[model samples]
Target: MRRSPWSTLVVLAIAQFMVVLDVTIVNVALPRMQTDLGFAPDDLQWVISAYTLIFGGFLLLGGRSADLVGRRRIFVAGLVVFALSSLAAGVATSPLELILFRGVQGLGGAMLSASALTLLMVTFEHGRRRTIALGVWGGLAGLGGTMGAIVGGVLVDNLSWRWVFLVNVPIGIVVIAATFFIIRESRAIISGRRTFDVAGAVLSTTGLLAIMLGVIRAEPLGWGSIEVIGLLAGGVLLLAAFVLVESRSAAPLIPLRLFRTRSLSLSVVALGLNSAGFLAMFFLTAIFLQQVRGLSAFDTGLAFLPMGIAAIVGAVVASRFVTMFGTRAVQVVAAVISVIGLLLLSTADASSPYASSLLPGLILFGLGITAMGVPAQVAAQSKVRTDDAGAASGVLNAGYQVGGALGLAVITTLATAHITDAMTGGTAPLAAAVGGFQFGLLIAAIFAAVNIVIALLSPSVTVDSATATEAAELEPVAI
Candidate 1:
């Protein structure tokens, strides 16, 4: 008997991991980037936000474009563009140049990310094949954040920040070559739509940028400032308009009907927290370990091993767990577990010992995070037609990316505010910074608790795949 025609999972997983790892790898390099480029403390968020904003903003369009054009072609194109952008970013001499190149890199990431999973889904037929492939895929998601930090620390400590971006150069080339050789072109289920949803895309992306900027800037600008208030209002209005436009359009960027699924809807909200807590923790922990606790990049990265290993093991474990007690139950428990970890993290301080203080929190957080991997992925893509699968997955991907962007902005702003406020009259500013980080992590824990409630709304069994269009369709079933 002939084997099913599956694309190269190894190449795809490696490519996808590169994209995900890039998200955090640069973080360990942030201090170096800031010093070399002479970036102001306040202006530094751009370095991080540059990639995420573009990635989140363009994800839907990228995903839809793959369906309209061809996944293999788009995926390869994305890799080439991403590789070039990495080179440009690595060699950048000025802060402005780095930010510009980072944005370009983000564009490529958006394109690659939007289509990678779609290709995988198409490559593997449903059932056992799909299950194994997805496990590998999900493991990448768990490992990416941790590995990025690990690699970033090693690179930044040994070579330079440039190495962080430069590392992608070779990896990208290899993935592209392998993709061409091992991957086959797959046509979109439906083709030749009259017009793309350009207007909706513009509105949605602009709105998201406004919101993220507002959140990030609220630290310096103050939440009550007109800039924050105006951006928030504008973002809300633009997003509302995006929704209205999507409803009226003949060819919508996001088929609003996808929200109809309870599982998909709730999973998105869950993923938002997952992305926020998981990714943001990496950023915050790295900064806190080095800046406040006076640890080196290598030390900070080494500290993350426990959490990283746990996330991968947990995700693999979750695949088996979800098949038994069902997704909803596993997710609810996962949320609670992660929340506990965040709560533990809130107790972290500049003077805290790695073993007595940070280790327990990271280990527990890793365990809970491990639980969320499968359910969130499954719920997000459980339903929907195979044709719309790319779009559907892109929705969750956007949520994940956008959520991380928002998390960085919101948590960073809150921490900054708390630190500034606490540093009255010559108080130790560094300690204040650590305290601020704790405050931010606490807020993240609260956010995850909301995820727990959302997960509780899911069902004890797998959702039916027929009516997966509605965003909140599967959510109601969980309750």
Candidate 2:
């Protein structure tokens, strides 16, 4: 049953990369998908949201499933489901069909993502091996932004958007086969008789769906709209109810007690804020590059390659710095560095050069993100029972999804309002609308700075993996 740690890392990273890459690959293809599928501008959001919302909403359940069933089995099952769904999506003739298939793909993606980390944890023994693995996993998440831009442009421009989905087919087959051969499976041990938390799952999932839907609709419908208000309210109430139910449930899908760790609580908050800034920054910058700088799609993708490479390099360095610099110090310093990057990004104008103005911020942001995210991820999963890796992973992923959703809403609203105000008296072209996006980058920088403040105040942060619990000591992969 033994497998080389390297084999396990490679398999898990591929799966994780696919899951994360999907988050952005569709960005460049939105226009083509709409034209071919007849999806309206508004409806196109679902192409992205459908995948993320389901993936985020069901992540907790998926994590728990991995523990109860088996990590390796669920992992492979997820890939099969994902691959089939991708094929369905690639060939879909209608928006509705594509959306449905996208949701299915998200479900499988959630399951695969939920198990991948736990397997990585169990595959590599605690100590240096785990750290390197974690660095790889964490690094890949950051690299997704750059890769998505490049791959999306190539596929959309040269071939077709469908390649984004079809490309997954071969990759999925290879990863699934390699995983089966290289990964060891683990199952959760239950005490006496335990029941699944059906009520808790229903409440939380519905609650999250409501909140996510409402948040995403804020810009289109206006936050003041009754429908948006109602959904948000209902989401908050259902989440509250879920918490109450979890308190009394015999076996909660999400262990409420995990929040007892000071480090875990702080890390999640930091992760969310950091993600908010990170996601919004890219959306804003891409618009700036294309609309403002007049860069071609291919050029935009090329512009991002450096940031991607820097992320991997920075993450490996950050992981090593954990023990020497101390996790908390690195976190605070990293947040500050990202803030500086965000600050630099805010200065970018139509006349600024990419190499000088943008590169500095991108590099700083890359380094800071790698440092903060990797450590926080390691910290969040460090104390939980190995069986709860899925839950732990889901929690971190939730922060990521929540942050992105919240950021998208906040930035879109702010940017639109500013742009609309400036052009209210005149009929401005699409360029004026794009100007609004630049201000969104400024707002995103503000959010990044907020994360820095949060990191600065969290004196409880520690990076020594030993400080994390025995079962939770598995290293993070930069993937």
Candidate 3:
């Protein structure tokens, strides 16, 4: 069943937008949620960490399930789970209840996100059309991250913090309905003896969960804590077991052979590194805006708007350049731009105005990250077979999720340590905080700089062969 590719993209993008939006939307609402739910100061982190850990942990399973079950089926099921969980979260009377619901929401998010990307890949044939569609997808994703703060602020200020979760209800319903009509059900066509790798799934899921748990707790517990060390070691051991299982299984959960694809392998590596820095940048920036600058939630969110706009523009520019030049060149250049952005950001201080110090760096970083991201995404998906779309998508998304969790954990610790030392050395509170942020941004800059080498390792591929004829031959979609 052939559906209009653009229409398919719209539905998929909307679903993915919700997934990404939830990652940061609650950030601005944390204060209100803490007050209303009577959450302890330390426990508040669970509100965010729960969602991230579950989402990151089960992504591989959710993605592979889409292939074994059905992409459209999993997508619709995810929406149902996500919507119900959102409603539950909105009305929760206690912190524990809200945290549990958020974890469920993350599970649904993993299901939707992986399948949506898979369906998009199968719907749009690999060519200029797919690249353009991916560009749009990447732009909307970046927009969602930026818009989360804005939307969360407005909802929290005008309505209530509950609206942050409640907002997804109507949007989820509409998208769920639209998805059935727009997306055709698709799944991997297995040859024979369809065997599910149960051991692989269990090991990988538990392993990821353990690692994410360790990372999330590291900030409060300290990285040197016995619990953190145990969790990290256990996760590594489980993942090692998973690798062994995959190598022996006839129908592996994640085919070890897929990593043999240079483009996909390199793309995932670069993305993981890029995401580490990107998430750290946002985390630090938000803290600086709210803590040091003493901006209201709404005002802090507004400060991020320019970066979002720059991200959209970057996606468009990257798509064009990939068509004209190639993936490797665009990725290399984008990495360089991101490094410059981070460097600029490091220069900001307590007295520095937003317009003069922060805005330029935000815009440049946003543009560079999104631009580099689109090509890497396209290249990764392009190199994989249709049967492995869900697996590949899952791996890609997991890289991003885990990278963010790990990055925020390490980066925030470094920043906090710096601030603690500065204060001990007789630095003022404001100056110490400012110095901490600068140091964090510098570390993030180093992460971005590493991407240049990673990008250089990409296989050069151009989408120009069908550019002229394909553009002329494309049909206009009312959607």
Which candidate's TM-score is highest?
Answer: 1
Off by over 4 Å in 3: 1-11, 31-46, 92-98, 120-142, 177-187, 195-199, 212-225, 378-390, 421-429, 465-479
Candidate 2, residues 169-274: lDDT per residue as tens digits? Answer: 9999999878767888897776765576768767876787788668666766888999999999999999999999989977776678878866677777887777
Q: Show how many residue pairs clash in every candidate, following the order shown.
A: 26, 20, 0
* Candidate 1 TM-score over all chains jointly: 0.89
Clashes of 2: 20
Between the candidate structures 2 and 3, which one is better when assessed by TM-score? 2
Provide TM-scores for the models: 0.89, 0.85, 0.84
RMSD of each: 4.5, 3.8, 4.7
The CA lDDT at 142 in model 3 is 66
Q: Write the per-residue lDDT of candidate 1 for residues 1-479, one digit (tens) a residue.
A: 01234447777788878887888788778877888889866566678877887787787887777877888888998899899999999999998899889888888988887678778878887667776676667666556766888889999999998999999999999998888778887756764555668798789878988998787777777789999999999999999999999999987888889999877787777777777776667667777888888887877788888887776566656666666677788888888888988888889887877887888888878878657746776766767678677567777767777776777777777766787788975568887887878988987888888888888787555643322212221111100
CA deviation > 4 Å runs, candidate 2? 1-9, 34-46, 92-100, 127-146, 177-186, 349-351, 378-394, 462-479
lDDT of 3 at 91: 97
Global local distance difference test of model 3: 0.78
* Worst ten in a row by lDDT for model 1: 470-479
> Model 3 — TM-score against the truth?
0.84
